[model samples]
Target: MKPVNKNDRLLVHVEDLTHDGAGVAKVEGYPLFIHGALPGEDVHIHVLKTLKSYGFAKLLEIENASPFRVEAPCPVFDTCGGCQIQHLSYEGQMTFKRKLVRDAITRIGKLPDVPVHPVKGMENPWRYRNKSQIPFGMEDGRVVAGFYQPRSHQIADTDICIIQTPEADSIMAGIKHKLTEMGIEPYEEETHRGQLRHVVVRKARATGEIMVVLVTKKKKFPQAAEALKLIQELVPETVSIVQNVNPEKTNVIFGDETITLWGKDVIEDQIGDVRFEISARSFYQINPEQTEVLYGQALEYANLTGNETVIDAYCGIGTISLFLAQRAKFVMGVEIVPPAIEDAKRNAELNGLSNTLFEAGPAEQVIPRWYKEGKKADVLVVDPPRKGCDEQLLQTILKQRPERVVYVSCNPATLARDLRILEDGGYRTQEVQPVDMFPQSTHCEAVAWLQLAE
Candidate 1:
């Protein structure tokens, strides 16, 4: 690692935002990443960490006004570090995000070809978040739940994040207060001897019933019984309350040992008159409104007809499969997690959607199973994790050679890399649409439609 030499407060204008919540600025003919600044704003920044080509900076003073700059909704919008786009006008934020997708395609994809679609926005930006994961910790012998500030490991106490339902914010104060009264110390990762790690809350947009899951490292808190008992009484709409004890130090969720203390473990959400079930660990878009638009775009671009058979790989709980099932002749979903597969089946049965079938196994095993059984799908939708499609999976996809491949991805680099595999396997890249799932953060989702080349 080379030492940073230039650390000067330069009058630099923030031109854009990097995918991971850093503001882009050109200082002295070099790119600088200034934290806590917005695009279209000119600000004097204090250069902090630097490299040969690029550096990071701290915002010092505003030199000029950006027409799109807006006062952040949350008081801790800048400090609590939850959202980075709160300072940017919602429309301007969408524009910045569109550029992010375009830039990502240019850098990751070999060819800059597809037109990045216009970003979709919501009628109400505030309270658009359907879910909120609040990090819980013991701060000075008290329980606090919120998000961490940008780049800092310490979790900042977030009172009100603009993304989620107001109920989520209202429940935070009560959660901390009750946990302290119960003598439950929030989990401390460094010490590894606290009761709570985080509070995962979800709200049904239609019912307003919220589900709260308390994440901890241990099973039994001294106040576990009483705390939940009180929570049910205080927050009546809190339909399902559960506890997840995650002992491992890794950031992965502790969903393996989930015990529902009250109500069902899942909630119901409807996307354009079609209802779907969301389990605690199931992958559902956080922003429901954006999800409707995203799914609609995906459905539209898929161009699926009633005659087509679709395969939805990595279909967690069959969100996409069931969504597309009604339009397709039949839909098959493959998932690695058996429990999720079971949930998918149950979801399908719950909604009386029998046209969709779910299989539990690695894509390598399941895809081959379908292949050996001489089953062929006309369209295949692959929505893998940020790591994207594994080589084995990609090989299986090639072998199967579904006529159409719809890849819904969270990471652009991985998506591009996977696209290259398909390209090499005689598939041509088709239209790609970028959706802003996470507003204030650098993370965004892209729906890339892939078609087999003749």
Candidate 2:
């Protein structure tokens, strides 16, 4: 190791916790985040960069180890950026996730009355990921596939990812080898003329059938057909193959053109005996097992009695809306994306569900329009995107005053902010639960049930 640059050096011990990684000690009464270190560990850190309030660092040594600290299994633990808490014990990870949600509600959202239960961790953390999105990048002048490194734009070449399903890992060697053999050009960010962008894989746990979606920058994905054939030959259990073209320069995913190469354009999966059809662009929880539990919790909080009408706002492909329709008199799902709404209707019809309906529009707009016609939604379930509910949607919900409001959020920071608005609008937080959908990562999903405040 190179000798220390003392000019930037600042030693500190971590005191509390941050959602990102490790918490840090106060140096001269200023908090400095000590990376690669665990809580309750005293460590000497070299401050790399200083911010206005806090600073970042690299751990020089661990003077004391936290009880929760455990050696991460993967070689790419800190580098790949896929999982952050691999160094943390499974039990401790759950504790940290729960506390983070509680703290977010209490401090960030300023909602102290709300109670957040201990975050639920997976039974078998490894092989839990049923879905994988592998980006294509050039390495050593050859096309390669793997996940990107932590907080960086560069993609790292790795074959084995411990978190995904066994089927996902099985096809890795073949996919990489074929992509290299075909000499498919990797997508260059500057030119945006590459034939390969990403290789998305999904597997149904119940059926053991896999679906591979090839994402390219251009429409002519001749390599995808050859690659899919090779993948099928290697693994015949692959039920379907699909392709999508993403030409946008931005990192955000909105597959510009979707084409199914073989089999079905949509993949099928079951959650708690209930089957669901998900297209390539549709949103389904990456972790299927945990999603069942989450839906159970949301349903419990909803207190549905089989006689009420439920409206699932921001319902992507009717996952929850269709699930609730089985019990409720009628379930109506609303989504902004047209493709997702179409998928929801097809899924509902495929499952022989007749009571649920899906529409395309903003929730705020839909909720108000429905209210004008005197539609009494006894229960309203909202599964919003990361940004959380908008102001107009909040106002519409309050005006309608549904018997119960179930708000499921992926971003706790935004969830907390929206909860405050709900509280101000006379809605009381009934319960909040956190689900550790993505282990080792800093992000978490939270559900907040609200009703008219007394």
lDDT of 1 by residue, 55-133 (tens): 8888889888778878876777767766777777878877877777777777777648866787766666677888888
Q: lDDT per model, in order?
A: 0.79, 0.80
Reference-based TM-score, model 1: 0.92
TM-score of each predicted structure versus truth? 0.92, 0.94
**Best TM-score among the predictions, by candidate number:** 2
Every candidate's CA RMSD: 2.5, 2.9
lDDT (C-alpha) at residue 367 in model 1: 81
Off by over 4 Å in 2: 1-10, 248-254
Off by over 4 Å in 1: 1-4, 248-255
